[model samples]
Target chain A: MSLSITVVVVTTSTALHAADKLIASATAAGFDVRVVARTGDDPIADVVKVAIAASSSEYVSIIESDGWLSGEAGAVIGGFLASHPGADIVYTDEGTVGRRGRIDVIAKPIFSPERLRCQFYWGDIVLYRRSLFDEVGGVDASVPGAELYDLALRASIAARSVEHIAKPLFIRSVQSDSGLGGIALESTRRALERHLASTGGGVVRAVGADGVHDTRRLVQGEPLISIVIPSRGIYSEIDGERRCYVVDAARSIMDLSTYQNFEITLVLDSVAESEVISELMAIVGQKLRIVEWTKPFNFSEKINHGVLHSRGEFVLLLNDDVQILEPEWLESLLALAQRPGAGMSGGMLYYKDDTIQHAGHGYYDGDASHIGLDAPRTDPGPLNGYRVEREVSGVTAACAMMPKALFIEVGGLSNLLPGNFNDVDLCMKVTWLGHDIYWTPHAELYHFESKTRDASVHAFEVDVAWGRWGFRMHDPRYWPYPHNRPPA
Target chain B: MTEITPDEQADYERDARQLALVDRIIGLEAQVAHLRSVNTSQALRDQLKEVKSSTTWKVGRLVLAPALALQRLLGRNADKDK
Candidate 1:
C-alpha cells in the first residue's frame, strides 16, 4: 500500500486561512489529513502529543497552520520511506511565501549534526516515524518554541537516520517581527542546553539575542588561543604610505584586541628585519613568536608549522592582510569554537572600503562563493540572515578559529591543496569528522583582501577539491538564491 | 639671519641630508609596495607562461597599444562630461 501519513496541522482558530490551505493540500496529496487546533496558552507539545496519539497512520507529518506541503511532497515522502524504511525522520527543502505570491526557496544541504547544533537550517515541516517518535517521547510540553529542534536532537541521539529531501516540499508565509519572543527564546535556550548536555558535557551560555541569536558551549576553563599568520612580509599601500601587512596585522592585534589570553605566531618564508622583529616583540611583549618556513610559499605547510610551534589550546589561522575591527571578535570566535559540535569558527570580514567581504561562504559548482560578497556594511541580504551566527558549509581561513587538538586530528590542512582550497578542504574535513563549521557575524574584521596571494592557484586547487571532496561542495547549506543581495 | 656660524651651517646641512635620506626611504618603500602588488605567485607564473605562448594572448597583446590610447581618451572625455 502507499505509505500512510497523518498531517498534524497545528494552528490557532483565528488564522484558519493557513490551516485551510494546508488541509486542502494534504487532502489533494492523498494523505489522511488530521488538523490539530490549539488556542490560548496551549503548548505545541501538548497539541502534537494528542495528535500523535490519535493518528492511526504509519507516519506523522508535522506542519504549522501557516505551513503547507508541495503537491508532490506526499508522493516524494512516501517514495523516500519506501526506499529507506529505516529512516525515522525526513525533512525537505522549504520556501518562504513573499509578497505578490513569490516564493523564496531556501535550498538546504543534506544532514550534518554539526550544522543543527549551531543553527536550525532544517525546516519545521518534517515527517516523523510514529514508532521512533513514541520510543523517544513524542514531544515535551515544556519546550514549546524549540520542540521540533529538541525532537530532532533526540531522534539523532537515538541513532535514527534523518534523511533530507533535496527538493522544496513545504511552503510557509513570511511574517515580520516573527522572531522568537520571550517564551520562545527560553524554550530555544533550554533545547540547545539539553542538546549540548546530552552530546558533550559542557556549560551552555547564551551569547547574543534578537535577530542574531548565539548559544555558546563553554568547555571547562579559559582555553589559550594561538593566532597564526603566514606571510612573506608583503607590504601594501594603505592611505598613501607603505606598511608591511604582517606587521600591521600583528600591531592591530596588540593594540586594538581585547582578547588577553592569546599568543601571536608569525610564520614567514623569509627572515624579517631585526628592527621589525624587535618592534613586533615590543608591541606584543611576550605574546609574540616567529617561525621560519624554509620552503615554498605553501600556506598549509606554514600553518602546520605554526601549530607545531604554538603552545595554545586553540589555533586561529589568520591572514596577514586582515585587521581587527571589534575588540571582542576573538572572544566571540573562541566561544563558537568551544561549542559542542563546532570544529571551526570564522569571522565576518569587511573590505577596506567597508563592503562586506566574507560573511560566510557557500560552495556552488566548483568554487566557494561569499555570502554578502560586495554588499554594503548594513545590507542584510534577502532575509537579514547574512548578519546572523549560523552554521555554514565552509568559511575562509582568513580568520578561522579551531581547537588545536582538532586541527591536529584532521592532519592540519591538506598539503595537496597548498595555496587555495586548503581552508575549504579543512572545513570539509572537520565536517567529515562529525563536527560543525560556524561563521559568526559577531566576530568582525577588516580584510585588506588577498594582498598576499594569487588567484591563479585557485583553478588547480579547484581541480584537487573536485577530485577529493566534490560531492560535498554541491548544494551547500547557504542556498544561493537569485536575490542574494538585500531587498529594497 | 639665523645661521652665521660654521657649526650652525654644518648642522643645517646635516639636517637637510637626513630629511633627503628619509624622503628617499619613503620613495623606495612606495616602489616596494607597487612591486609587491605586481608580484605573481608560482601558479600565476605558470598561467602567465601559457598565456604568453598562446596565439590569442599574442593577438590581444598586439591590440593593447590602441586599446590603451582609446581607453585614455574615453576616460578623459568621460571625466570632462562628469
Candidate 2:
C-alpha cells in the first residue's frame, strides 16, 4: 500500500525561520508541504480547503504557524491510515516548544467523542481522511476559537472509525499572552449544549475565568449516592497528634459535604470496639452501614461486598485516608459522572502539605504512573490538563464514582487481581465496553495515602494484570507510547 | 494533499516496513515476558506470602515509618524552597 500524506500549514503570516524549520522537517519526512494563508475576511476553514486542494494525497494534516511536525510523522500517519483503512480521523500525541523549553508533552488517549464536548484533549496535530473531511463539510468557519473542536465533533459523528497514534506527531509553540478566550469559551458552551441535548440532556456552564467547564447532567430528581470506604480504623500522626483515618474521613463527609443525598458504607477489614462503632453511629445516625470482613484482605472483594449492600443509584469508591477539602466536591464529581458516556469520575487528590497525590493515571513503562504526582497544587500540568475536566485512560478508585448499573455491567471489579492494578483493570474493562473515564480537578481532596495499607503488590497480581491487559496497554486509549510524564 | 512520486513512495514504504518490524519485535518481547511470568508467578506469590507472614517484615515496616515521615518532611521542605 502506498503511504501518501500532505502537510497543510495554516498561517496568517509564517515566521521566516519557523517556516524554514517546518519545510526542512517535512522534506526530511518525505512529505510535500503547502502554505495556506488567511485573508482576514475569510474563515479559517476556507484556508484549510485551499490547502487540501493543493495536494492529492490520501491523508491531510494541518499544522499551525507555531507548530512543526515531529520526525517521520508523515510516515507514521500514512502507515497507520493504510493499516486501519476504516479510520476517518486520526490524531497523535503532541508537545509544546515554549520559552521554558519544550513543555506540555500532551499524551492523549484514544478517541473519546463525549469528552470532545467538554475539553480538547487531542492537540492540533490531526490527520483527516479527505473523504470524511468533505463529508463533514470541513470545519465550521463560525467557531474561530473552537474551529478544530467543531470540526472534530462533526467528523466524529460522521466517522465510522476514529483513531489515535501513541507517538508525538507535532510540536506547538506556546503563545505567552494566549489563553482560551471568551469567544472560545462561548463557542464551546454552545457546542456542548448541542452535544448534551443530542446525547440526552444537560447544561454546559463555564465556571470562573480559567477555561474550566462544568457539564451538569440533568438530575432525574435527587439521586442517592453510596460512598464506600474500605477501613481498618488505622491511626496516623497528623499535625503533631494521632488521628484515626476513618473517623476523619467520615467526619469530613458528614460535615464538609454540601451534597445531602448520600449514604456511607464502611467495609471494615478489622474489628472496631463497640464504643468506637457507637460513637460513629451517634455522629452519622442512620446514614452509615458497617459490614465486617473476617476474610483475607482483597481490596476488590471488599468493594464488591460493599456494592452488594449499597442501595444508592451511584457508588463512590473512596479511601478512608482522604478528607474532602471542598464542600462542593461530591457535587462536582456527581455532575461529571452523571454526564453522558461517563464510566467513572475521579477527583484530583492532594497531599496534606498541598502537593499532588493523583491527578490522573497515565500508563508508562508497563505500569501506571500518577500524572502530576507530587507536583504543587498551582502547577498547570501538561497543556493545563491538570486544571480541567477531561477524559483519561483511568482514574484511581480512591474517589471514583460511577452509576451502580454501569458497575454491575462491568462485573464490579476483578476478583483475581488484588491491590495494585485492580482499579486500573476495572477501568480498562469499563472503557473496553465503550465508556469515557473523566478526571476533574474541581473535586479536590487531601489524601493521607499509603496510610491504611502496606501499599505492597504481590508478584502474582502484577503478572495477572500484565497477562490480561499488557497487549492492549499500547492501544493509546489506555496507554500511549513514548509515555511522556506530565510536567510538574 | 500533495502527490508522492516513485522515489518518495519508496521512502515511505521503507519507513512503514521499519515501524511494522519495531511493533512486531515489541509484541514478541511481550510474549516472552508473559511466558516467563507464567513459569515464575506461583513461586513469587508464595514468597510474597511468606515474607508478609514473617515477624522480620513487620518489624522492618514499623522501623521504616519514622524514615518515611522524615522523608516526607524533607520533600515538603524542598518544595517550599522551590
Candidate 3:
C-alpha cells in the first residue's frame, strides 16, 4: 500500500515563525512528513525536491510553512485518488490567511499556452503525483519571487491534464510580509513574453498604454462585431423569439446607435420547439443572420463554435435578456477594450430597483464567493489602479467583450464550466497576461430576466468555481472581495 | 401805472397766494393721513397719558425715550439704504 501522504514543510528564516500553525496542522493530519528549511540554500526548490523524494505515497503536496492544510484534506485526497487511479495531479481551491483569511481560485481559462512561462501560475494549493514532480525536476527557487510558479508551469506544460478535487483542501494564509503578489505578476509577464516569442509573436508592442480613450479612434471604422446568444426553450422570457431580442436588439442597436458600421450574428442551438425557431426568424429581419447548430448545451463549447464561425475582430458574448442603456455602449466598450493589454470589458449590472448588481467584476475571498463589481460604491477612483482604468481582478461573462486574439490565446472559454462562472476564470487568466479587464459605467445592462439564476449555483457550478479558484490568490487587488457594489 | 394796473395786480397777487395756500393744505393732509394710520386710538390713549407725563414714547435716541419706549423697541430692524 502506498504511504498515505508526505507533507513537506517549506520554511525560510524570514517567515518561519509564520508557518508554525501550518506545520503543526500537517503533523496532526497523520501525514508522513518532512520539514525542510534553507538558510542560504534556496528554500523553495530545496523543499519541493525533499518533499518529492521523501514521499512513497501515490500523492504529494507542497505545504508552505505559512499555509494550513484543512483537517479533512488528507481524507479527501485519499478518496479522490482511490476514485481516479489515472489522475496525474489533484489540486484544491485554497483559502489564504492574509490581513484576513480569504480563499481564492485559479480560473479555467489558464489551461492555455499563456502559462508557458514559469511566472503565470497564481494559486498554489498543489497536490500532485510524486512521479510527475520527479520527472519534471520539481521547483526552481532561482527565479527570484517566482519559484513555485516556475515549477507549476513546467508541470502544466508536461502533464497530460490536471485534475481538481473542488474542495478547500489547502489553506494558504497571509503573513505580515508575503511576496505572493509581486511574485505572481513577475511570473505572468515572463510567461506571456515566452509564449509570444516561442510562437513568433513579438514582445508586447506599446500603443495606447495611456488608454484607448475613444473606441472609434482606437479601432476606427467599426471592425466587424459578431453578437452570440445561446438559446434554450426559455424563449419568451429571454424575449419574443430568441430572434426578437436579436431584432429589438438590432433595432435597439440601430435606434440607440448613431454609428452604422456593424452587423449581428445569432447562434441558435437545437431548441426543441419549432415555435422558438419560427419566432426568432420572423422577428429578426435583415438586421440579423442566424446560424443553427445541433450540438448539446455546453456554454463554452458553443461559444468556441461561435468564435470560429465569426469573422469579426471583436466578439461580444451577450445574454438575450439585456436592454440597451447607453445606445453607444458598443463604441465606448470597444474603445476601452481596444487598449493594448485590455483583454475584456463588461457593462454595469442593475437590479430592477435600479440598485447595483455589479459594476464590472469583483472577487471572492474564502469567507464568501462571487462579490459584485463596484459593491456599495466608495470614492470613485481605483485604490491601486494599474492605469487609468479601474483594474479589477476579474470580470463576469454576462456582458463582456474581448479581442478575438486574446480570447484565442486563453483557449476561448472552458467547456467544463457547462452551466456557470466560466467567464470569471477567463477574466483571471487574461488579466494575468498583463492585460487589463475594465468594467464600464458607460456600458450598462440590467438583468431583470432570471434564467441565469437557475445556474446561480448548481453542484458543478460550485465545483468548477471551487476548482477554478484553485489558482487566484487572495491579495489587496481583490481585497474588497465578498463586498457588494453600491447599488446605482 | 403801466407796469401793473392796481386791480389786475391785486387779482394776480391773490391767485399766487391762493396757490401757495393750496400746496400747504395738501402737505398738511398727507401728514394727517400718516398720523391717522400709525395712531390707533386705543394704543394712543395709553401713549398719550405717558407722553403727557413725558415718561415714554420716543422717536430718536437723541431724546424723548420717555414718550415712546415700546414703539422704538418694536420698530423694524430693516436697513435704510435700500
Go through the candidates in order and give the C-alpha RMSD of each one to the true structure: 17.2, 19.6, 32.6
Determine which window of 10 residues in candidate 3 chain A has minimal summed lDDT: A208-217
List of clashing residue pairs for candidate 2 = A55-B1, A55-B2, A56-B1
Q: Candidate 2 residues A1-488, lDDT tens each?
A: 23467777666653445567776777677776777675543458877887788778876767654667787676787777768988778888877775668556667767765456556666676777888888877777777656676677677777888888877777767662245667766666666676677666777766334444566555556799999888875555766898778887898889998889999988876565555566667777788887766679778778876776678999999998898988878887887788778899898998877888888777765667676777788987655667767778888898899998888766676666657787877787677678878887878999987423366777887776676667555444533433344322
Candidate 1, DockQ to 2 decimals?
Answer: 0.01
Task: Spell out the clash pairs found in candidate 1.
Answer: none
Over the stretch A395-443, how does candidate 3's per-residue lDDT look in tens digits?
Answer: 6676788887777666667665666767866775676567877655657
lDDT of 1 by residue, B1-82 (tens): 0113677546544643443353334334434544564546976999989989999988887889798899999999999999
Listed models, DockQ each: 0.01, 0.02, 0.00
The best candidate by TM-score is 1
Sort by DockQ, best first.
Answer: 2, 1, 3
Q: How much lDDT does each candidate structure score?
A: 0.72, 0.73, 0.56
